[model samples]
Target chain A: MRPRLFTPGPTQIPERVRVAMSNPMMHHRGSEFKEILAGVIDDLHYFFQTEGDVFVLTSSGTGAMEACVVNLLSRDEKVLTVSGGKFGERWGELCVAYGANTHIHNVPWGDAVNPDDIKKFLRENSDTRAVFITHSETSTGVASDVETIAGIVHNNSDALLVVDSITSAGVLPFKMDEWGIDVAVTGSQKGLMAPPGLSVVAMSQRAWERVGSSNMPKFYFDFKKEKVALAKTATAWTPGITLLMGLRESLSMIRAEGLENMWANYARLAHATRQGALALGLELFAHSPSDSLTAIKVPESIDGIKFVNRMREKYGITVAGGQAQLKGRIFRIAHMGYYDALDMVAMASAVELTLRDFNWNFEPGAGVRAVQRIFMEDE
Target chain B: MRPRLFTPGPTQIPERVRVAMSNPMMHHRGSEFKEILAGVIDDLHYFFQTEGDVFVLTSSGTGAMEACVVNLLSRDEKVLTVSGGKFGERWGELCVAYGANTHIHNVPWGDAVNPDDIKKFLRENSDTRAVFITHSETSTGVASDVETIAGIVHNNSDALLVVDSITSAGVLPFKMDEWGIDVAVTGSQKGLMAPPGLSVVAMSQRAWERVGSSNMPKFYFDFKKEKVALAKTATAWTPGITLLMGLRESLSMIRAEGLENMWANYARLAHATRQGALALGLELFAHSPSDSLTAIKVPESIDGIKFVNRMREKYGITVAGGQAQLKGRIFRIAHMGYYDALDMVAMASAVELTLRDFNWNFEPGAGVRAVQRIFMEDE
Candidate 1:
């Protein structure tokens, strides 16, 4: 059986998109590729909801995050990073790595950062250069209030609001320009329904001004060089050509299905996944969950690792177990990209079967029934 | 008609590899992907010909080049960079970007750096932390004597010999361990017969020691994190999953054909290309040409850009024009990865057609005849 991917990132790709990428490889610098790149950039503006330019990079989401850190802030500059989960903590770590005077505002795991806390921090430290936060923390399946935080940062201080929107951008209704976000970064493998290796960065005009004055050392991920090349419909260096080709198709698919519809679809899937887990007598992990993935607390009676492994090894359903401190305590069911109501139903069925194998207290069809009810009601 | 890729990078993908990647996208963190990663790493050892650890980075060749610099040298550390072409000049540019005290030894555009010069430079600058050079200068089509330079660095100084083997690794007969090289970085698109987006690095024991002590800032391209993750047959971050899948097939093809056989095939193709260009009354561009690609000086009568454009526009063949200072003065036909003698013949025929279009004086069928003769005689 073909494996079903329920992991947060590296989500399943649609067959149409896969077929599009199988066409003969083309020269990245040629006119044909430039046209495709231009189209991809246009569609990216739609998804990002930004009037400013978006740069496509050749590395993972972390690379884009690093690019933003280097481009916006100089060493010894003070920045505030919200640390709620693994991804949120990465922002703080990146700031630390660059020798930025960083203040990490740690939120409880499985909980979203409070917007008021950010306002208070910014008010207390008026000299903050930027604020780094994650829109959707994939590790804990939490979605922070980025819209509110953007307003807080804008009102409270002159700090630029940078958002790690890797798991949120297209999956959520994010308006980069309307919300006044300075920098937003995302990866292709998540909401774009494409392969990994390409990361897109949408920088506001405000962010671009800081890029020139920033004293951070950079070469491969230099934003100004990328900007110059983008103006000419080219890249500063050799891009991830195949991934860009695939992204052209994936972004087309996203456009065909309006961004609002895609966001609503993920929301329905997230709701169904949460209801399904609850029907299986599993507790939901996140206080404010992201629509991209649903994390469920592993019961004391069951072994989380074996449950995740059996779902993959036996049923060809790959779900991710929790990472870092949450290891062996939770399993995540991702609903981002190329997923439908039926896929969620299938995921629910797989969970039901696995729960039975682990001798947990759950009805045979309870999880699937709950998931079907949610989908049926939505329709 | 299907367009043919003759540019140095974003090379044509093999049918088998494309088909392999077209399969359902697998979860990168799953056991299935781990197995694929293990197999890929194993085959990488064969191609790199190294007992030391090799890293697979998810960016273009330039990213791996930056990784080596950041990992090996701290700020203000002394380094010598050999600049012969656009790519060779990039080594010095990256060093300068990272605040390294770099002395770039400028060689004439088409000429390779002399090994004796490197020996003398190392003797004069005994405190040099690293020596950077390019094995194959893609822009100028020149190949430096890295083997001889390796001996010079080993005998003369305690400096690490870093080589950009992006175009040379699989196309040329290179033995990393036997040659006693310190750090060699290559890309997947050129010599590995794969689509772009991935780069590989082979670091010797001596290079690894410098990585930890070096105080340069790094996060996404951290060699230590990648090395630790590689021991478990995984990447430190999300890798280019689809590209890696394609590379697994490409590497298998390389192994089945044998590394030495692959090198010989590229050599034969390069030889045929060179002879064909000479038969067209075109002068060779490089003094010490790399087998990966052949650079020919564009006749003053023909517009180099127009010639390259016509080859792609009418004949569906894409060859590269010269970069930087040689722009509009030279054209390059690449023989690297996934090219055969017949492909070289086709390239020659396309060159003849375009040369005729430009009204250049060259005998009809002479170029084709020369390429055919080389192939026929080699057989």
Candidate 2:
């Protein structure tokens, strides 16, 4: 049997997205492709809720994060990176490589960043140019307070609010212009409901102003050059044409349901999952949980690594385990994009069955009952 | 009608490869994915004809070219770049961006670099760290004599011979071991008969020796990180899983046909294409033509841009025009991977009809007859 994906990113791609990508190759410079590019960019704006420059870069999500660092900050510039999880730590590494004086606001694992900590760091380093944060920390299943943090940054120093919303966009709520976010980055394989390969960046006019004076030595990820070609309905380099086509279909689906409706759907799924895990005697790992995914501690008697493997090997259902320090302690279940109510029911059943087979002390179907009750309440 | 692709990369994908990619997504960190990765790497070794390491990077072909520069050469190192076409110019750009003092041995566009110029430049600059060249310059339909240049580079100095064989890997004859080439990069969308997301780099033992002492700051495109992951059948990043799966099928197809037969097929198709263009009173642009593609100057009276559009709009065939300086002066027809003898015949007929529509003076049926005769001779 083909294993179903329950990891945060690379969730099960929708059938429509797969069929759309199966079409023949396209010439990126031709009118057909230009028309496709224009429509996709428009939908990206609609989904992002921003009328700013969004360049579809052909790379992994990490590439977009690198672009934000290299294009918005020069050498020895003061920047604050909020390091709570693995993805947040990436910002500090990228900034350090580009010769930035980086200050890391460390948060404990399985916890979101405190807005006051960022404020404290900024007050001490008054000349910080950019404040980097991850919207949804994939490693810990925690969603930071981006809106509250954005307001704090805007009210204080003139630091640009940069976000890595890779696992959050299209799954939860993100308002770029309304929230005053300067720059936000995402990847295709995450909540975008498309395959991996394309990274996207949407920058506000304020961010563009900072980019004008940036003197970083970059070629492939140059936002200025990509923005110019995007104005001409082209990309600066040869794009992942098939993935772009898949993204077009995926975006249309999001638009059809509306972004708010999509967020509501994810909220319902995540709530049911947490309730089910709690009913089955599992502990929730994150204090501020994200609708994107849920990190749960293994039952006291069962081994976390063995439980994760049994779910994959016997049941053909794949979930993600912890990384770095959390390894062998917790596992993650994603209710991100392209998942529906029945997917929730099926996953709940799988968890219940896996625990039962492992001889754990839990009521059979308790997890599935929670999922059914929550789904019924929503319906 | 759907247009058949005749442009150099992003060639027509086979249905088998498409179906393979359309399968459900696999978890990148799972055992199933590890199995796929192991088989793919073994086949990559078979295709690259190298006993050294091969890293499958998830980006456009330019990503691999950039990897070579940022990983091998340190800041302020002397390097010689042979600039003959658009891709060749990219080597100098990347080297300069990475703080290398690059010297360009300029070969005019539409021409290939002579090996003697490289020898003269190397004799003058004994401390050159690397000699960058292109195996097939896609923009100009030219192929430099990499074997000859590699001999000269190794004989004169300890400079590594790096090549961008984006359009020539499976389409043209390449002998990495026999030729003493240190590094050669190619993309999946061209001769590999896959999509445009993955880049494959073959590194020699000699190149790894140089890499140990290099101190260029990189993270995503880090060759050492990628090489370490590749040893265990993995990539450092979340790769394009669909494209990698598609590549497995595509590489199997290439192996079934044998690399020598594939090269012969491309040569035959390219020979017929050039003769057909000559029959249409078109001037062949490249002096040292690559078997991957054929560049033809437009007839004196017909506009090149309009002719290219007519082929796309009226004939359901897609070809590429020149890049950079020669944009409206020439059009390119690719006979790379997944093209058959009939594809050449159909493309030749379209060129003939399109020219006749524009009232250009050309003998009727001459191009088609040339294709038929050449195909028959090869058969």
Candidate 3:
């Protein structure tokens, strides 16, 4: 049986994208690859809704996130980071590794930090040169208030706003210029419906200027050199050519669907999932959930890992377990990338079955009924 | 028409390997991916013939090369680098970016640096902590004397030997422990018969100890964290699952052919290419050529770029031109990955047609006849 991917990343790839990846290998320095790379850049700019430099790297989203910190700030530079989930804490860790003076705005798990808190931290720490935030916290399925946070960062000082949009770029609304985000990074697998090799980093002019002055140790991820090479529609080294071909196909699919419509679709699926979970008497983990994925707190009697494993082993439905302190307490079901109403229903049914097997009392048809109700109500 | 890829990297992926990349997406943290990752690591160790730790990263070979330098050397540490070809020069560039004191053994392009020269340099500069060299210089199709260089470094001082095996790993003879190579870096695309996203870095215990004390900024490519995570057969960050799948398939093919036999095959093909080029009245660029690729100097009257472009446009074949100062003087034909006698015949035929188009005044069947003669003579 083909297992459908409900996991946050390595999400289900479309047939067309997989077929695209199987195309014959091409020389990376050739005219054909250049055309493909240039097309990907243009499509990414359109998707990001920014005229800023959008570059692709042959690594996961974390590499792009690291590039953001490494390129933007010098050693011992002040940075304010928000840690509300696993990914949020990753920013602080990277900053510390880079020898940056970091001020962490720690928040409770499964909750978004308030924009006012960020403003207060920045105002008090006048020496801070940047603020790092996660647009979608995959661990808790919470989306940050990026628009408000960016505005606050700009008004407070000259601190640049960097966002890890790995899970939110195509699933939700992310306007780099309009939202005043100085830097945003995303991966290819999540909402892009491609494999997990390519990463995109979009940077504003201000961020590039900062990169120019920063003296950090970097070569492969050197944004300045990469930009220079990419200007001629090439990478500083051999790129993931197959992944780029898959991305070209995926971007076409995204364009065919339209960005606004894709966002709307995710919103609809997230609402249906939340309604379905509630109908099954399961509480949501995040106060403000992201459209990308939904984290549901497992009952104290039921182990979250076991729940996830059962879904995989029994129903061939893969989901994600909690990280860090939330371990064995929550599981996440992603609604991004190649998902539709049918997938939502299937996931709801799988969840209902898994809960029943775990001896949790829930109505047999409650989850499916709730999703259908949401769909009907939307109409 | 499907184009044949003869470039050094982004080489021709085997049909089975391409099929493997079409494997359904899996959660990186799941048991399935972990199983696959563990298998890949074990196979890598078997192929590399080392008991040292082998770490996989989601970037090109350059990322692995940088990882070796940044993770093992502290700022201002002295390193002796050999600059013979494009990749050899990369070591110095990485050292400069990381604030290291670099001493160069600058050899001209298309030539190998003598190990005695490195020993002399290390004797003069006793403060050098490491000596970096490229095993196979893809830019010039030259293979260096890494074993002798390693012996000299070990005998003279405590300087470690680092070899960039990006283009040589699976196609050539590289016994890490036997040769006393402290660090070896390779990519997936060149001789591994896979795509270009994955990089492998194998480090000895001594190098690991160095990594422990070195203080450099790293997160995504952090070997310490990656090794820890890989103990449980998982990656520190999301991996390129599809590419890993392709690599697994490629390694299986390597195992089927056996490492030593595969190396012999590469050497045989390289000899045939050299004989064919000579029969076509072309000059070989490198004094000591590598089995991974063959470089031929075009006549002064014929433009190298024009020859390469015409081969692609007319014969649907792709080859590489020289880099830097050597551009328009030499063209490279890669015989790495999934190639056999038939492929060689086709490549020779294309080269013959291409040279004729440039009015090189060569006999129509000269190149093909030369390759056939090599085959018959071997029989």
Model 2 / residue A244 / CA error / Å: 0.9
Per-prediction interface RMSD in Å: 0.8, 1.1, 0.9
Task: List the candidate 2 regions with Cα displacement exceeding 4 Å.
Answer: none
lDDT of 2 by residue, A270-371 (tens): 999999999998899999999999999987678889999999888888999898888888899888868998898999999998998889888998999998
CA RMSD of each candidate after superposition: 0.9, 1.1, 1.1
| Model with the higher DockQ, candidate 2 or 3 | 3
Give all candidates' CA lDDT scores: 0.92, 0.89, 0.90
**If scored against the real structure, what TM-score would every candidate get?**
0.99, 0.99, 0.99
Candidate 1: tens digits of C-alpha lDDT, residues A16-121:
8788777778888888899989999999999999999899999999999999999999999999999999999999999999999999999999999999999999
Q: Which stretches of candidate 3 lie over 4 Å from their true place?
A: none
lDDT computed for candidate 2: 0.89
* lDDT digits (tens) for residues B1-379 of candidate 1: 6688899887777998888777888888777899889988899988889989998999999999999999999999999999999999999999999999999999999999999999999899999999999999999999999888999999999999999999999988898988989999999898898888999999999999999899999999999999999988899999999889999999999999999999999999998889999998999999999999999999998888888888889999998998989998998888887888788888899999989999999899999999999989976
lDDT of 3 by residue, A1-379 (tens): 5688998887888999999898888888888889999989999998888999999998999899889988899989999999999999999999998889988889898889999998888888888899999999999999999999999999998999999999999999989999899999999999888989889999999998899899777788889889889878898878999999999999998988899999999999999999999999999999989999999999989978889899989999998889899899999988888899889999999999999999999889999999877888878
Best by lDDT: 1
Candidate 1 regions off by >4 Å?
none
How much is A51 displaced in model 2, in angstroms? Answer: 1.0
